[model samples]
Target: MDTTDDARTRIDTTVAHPARRYNYWLGGKDHFAADRASGDAIAAAMPGVKLMAVENRAFMGRAVRYLAEQGIRQFLDIGTGIPAPNNTHEIAQSVDPSSRVVYVDNDPIVLTHARALLTSAPGGANAYIDGDLRDPEAILAHPDLPATLDLSRPVALLLVAVLHFIREDEHPERIIETLTAALAPGSYLVASHATWEYLPAEVIAALTRNNTDGRFQARTAARFAELLAPFDLVEPGIESVAYWHADDVPGPRPSAEEVACFGAVARIR
Candidate 1:
C-alpha cells in the first residue's frame, strides 16, 4: 500500500498481468480494469476460484510458519504478487524475527510497490527483485538476494500460484531444478499450484477454453506431484491448499473440490 507515483509509472494497465489478476481475485485494490475482466471470466467459468485464492493464501502462511518453527530463517518467495497481509516475511518474522526474505516478481506494478514489500521487522531483512521465474539464472544471480539470504544455509523456496502461468512446454520443472540446485541441501520447497482434476469434464473444458488465450495451464494432481521430484514431501503429502497443516485454524472445512489447488511442502534432503 506504500505505492508511489514513480512506482505506478512502470505499470501498463492496457494488458492483464498475472499478479494484478491474482490480486483482483484476492479482493485487493492493486489491479486494473484489464485484470478485473480476466478475473471475472475465470470466476464465471469456475465459481470457486475466489475460494482457491483465499485457501492458497492460508497455505502459504501455515507453510512459512512451519518452516520458521523448524529453524529455517531465510526465505526466497518467488511469484510474490501484490502486497498483501501476512505475506511470507511477516509470517516467518512473527515466529523468528531474524528471518530474511527475498521477494521476486516480474510485474511492473509489483516492482513499483517495492516499499511495501521491503518492510521488515527488527533483526530481519527484506528485499525485492524485479525478475521472472521463467528465467531462473537471472534471479539466482541477482545481487539483492545474496545481500538478504545465505545460500550456504537453509532457505525456503516458494512457488505458490506461479508455475501454472508457465506452460508445460516452457520446461517449468527445469526452471525449478535450476533454482533449487543452487540452494543448500537443507533448503526447502513450498508450493501451491492450480489443478483441475477435481472438476467435471464439461467444467474443465469450459475453463480450459476460457483460459487458452490467457495462458493458464492447470494440471492434474499426479502431474503436480512430479514438480517436487527434487525434494522429499512432508507428512500428509500433497493435498488441497486449504487442508495442508490447517487443523490449527478454527473454521468450517472446505472440500478439496471447492479449493481446486494442490499444495505441498518438501525438504531438499
Candidate 2:
C-alpha cells in the first residue's frame, strides 16, 4: 500500500466518488456527506439501489468461489472498491489457502484501506496495485502482479460492478481483450455489469445525472455479454447478479428487480 500523503491528497471529499458511494450503500461509514447525498439521490430515484450493491458483492463472492472450485489459484482483481467482507482473496483462499491474488484500483481511498484487503493464508500471496482499468497494459505490467501471480497458470480476472463507469468510447472490450490475451487458455473472466433492462428510460436518465462526472453507463444484457465473447461462458450465463449462482448465494436472496446488474463467469478457450 502506498499510503503516501500525496496519493491521499488526490481524493476529493467535496465530490462524490463511486467507490465511496458504493461503500455508503453497503452500510459502511467510510463515506462523507457528498457521497451520502449522491447515494441517497440515486436510491430515491430508483428504489432498492442499496440492494443492488449488496447483490453485486454477493455475485463477486459466488464467482470467486466458483473459480476456486475449478482449481484456479491466481487472481487479478481490478476495480476493487473499498475493502469489504468476502473479498476475492478471502473467498479464493478459503477454498485453497495457496491461492494468490493481486488487487488493482486507482482509488486512493481504496489504497488507503489496502492493508485490510491484502491478507493471505499461510500458502498464499496477496498484493495491491494502484492502477485503473482504462489502462490494461499498465495493469498487466504492474511489477507486483507477476510476483504474486504466475502468468503461465490459470488465473481468474474479476471485474465486478466496475465497467459501467467506463463509457463506450473508452473501448472496454479492447481493454478486456488486452488483459485476456495476457492470460493462458484455461484462465477465467468473471464480470458483473450494471444494466438498464428493468428500468424505465426516465429512471435511467435520472441515475445518469446522479452519478458524478456524467459517467455510469448501463448497458443491455446482450451488450454486457459481448464483453466476454472471446471466452466460453460458464453455466447460468449473463443472468442477473442475484441469480448467477443462486445455490452458492448465502442468506435470503435479493429479487431480480433489486439487482440491475448482469453477472457471468467465462473461461478462455
The TM-score values for the models, in the order shown, are: 0.95, 0.95
lDDT of 2: 0.88
Model 1: per-residue Cα lDDT over 7-110, one tens digit each: 67767898888899888988899998988988898788899999999999989999999999999999999999999999898999999888999999988888
> What lDDT does the true structure give each of the candidates?
0.90, 0.88
Question: Residue-wise lDDT of candidate 2 within 1-269, one digit each (tens)?
Answer: 53656568898898888899999999998899999999999998888788899889988998898889989999999999899888899999999999999999888888888788887889999999999999999999989999899999888998888899889999998999999999988999999898777888899888877765758888998898788887899998888888887885567877777778889999887
Q: Mark the regions of model 1 whose C-alpha exceeds 4 Å error after superposition.
A: 1-9
